[model samples]
Target: MFYRHDNWRVGLNFKNLFDKKYYESQGDWIRSGAPFTVLGTVSVEF
Candidate 1:
């Protein structure tokens, strides 16, 4: 984590580490989550 009063921060996230297959359903409709993903993020607090 970044220190307090910091001007900016950076972070990384990894999702679906195993890359499995699955489905999400609602109202006879289906959606799927990603198999594998990587993300980078930045934040600035006022």
Candidate 2:
């Protein structure tokens, strides 16, 4: 979700909303993905 107003801005983001478990494999290497995460931001013009 995101919002903006008169030279100002706000935003929110989500990576894994369900918090599920998963893995990745490349060649002979194995890795795991991230869990539930959230991000927010705010900005303004000069």
Candidate 3:
């Protein structure tokens, strides 16, 4: 188990932010980054 700061937190979250799809036909057409990626950020003040 792990514990992190439990203070006022301001955060931003994104899930499946990008709806990218890859098909076998386009096997080599995939981008360097993964599809349906997520991005988040958190800030806290004690």
Candidate 4:
């Protein structure tokens, strides 16, 4: 979701909305993935 007004802007982002469990493998390494993450941002221009 996002919103904008004049010179100001706002936004939201979701990486993992379901809160699921997962993993990742790279070469000889194993890593766990992020769960149920939410990111938000805002900006203004002069």
- Identify the leading candidate in terms of lDDT: 4
Candidate 4: lDDT over CA atoms? 0.93
Q: Could you give me the TM-score of model 2 versus the true structure?
A: 0.74
**For each predicted model, how many residue pairs clash, with residues at least 3 apart or on different chains?**
0, 0, 0, 0
Which residue pairs does candidate 2 place in steric collision? Answer: none
Off by over 4 Å in 3: 1-9, 13-16, 21-31
Between candidates 3 and 4, name the one with more favorable TM-score.
4
- Candidate 3, residues 1-46, lDDT tens digits: the string is 1234777455555544666555433655745444675555666666
For model 2, the superposed segments whose C-alpha errors exceed 4 Å read 25-29
- On TM-score, who's better, 1 or 3? 1
Find the candidate with the highest TM-score and give its number: 2
> Is 2 or 4 the stronger prediction by lDDT?
4
Instruction: Determine which window of 10 residues in candidate 3 has minimal summed lDDT.
Output: 1-10
CA RMSD per model (angstroms): 2.8, 2.1, 8.9, 1.7
TM-score of each: 0.63, 0.74, 0.26, 0.72
- lDDT accuracy of residue 31 in candidate 3: 52
Candidate 2, lDDT over the whole model:
0.92
Whose TM-score is higher: candidate 2's or candidate 4's?
2
Model 3 pairs whose backbones collide: none
Measured with C-alpha atoms, the lDDT of residue 37 in candidate 3 is: 55
Question: Candidate 4 — which residues are off by over 4 angstroms?
Answer: 26-28
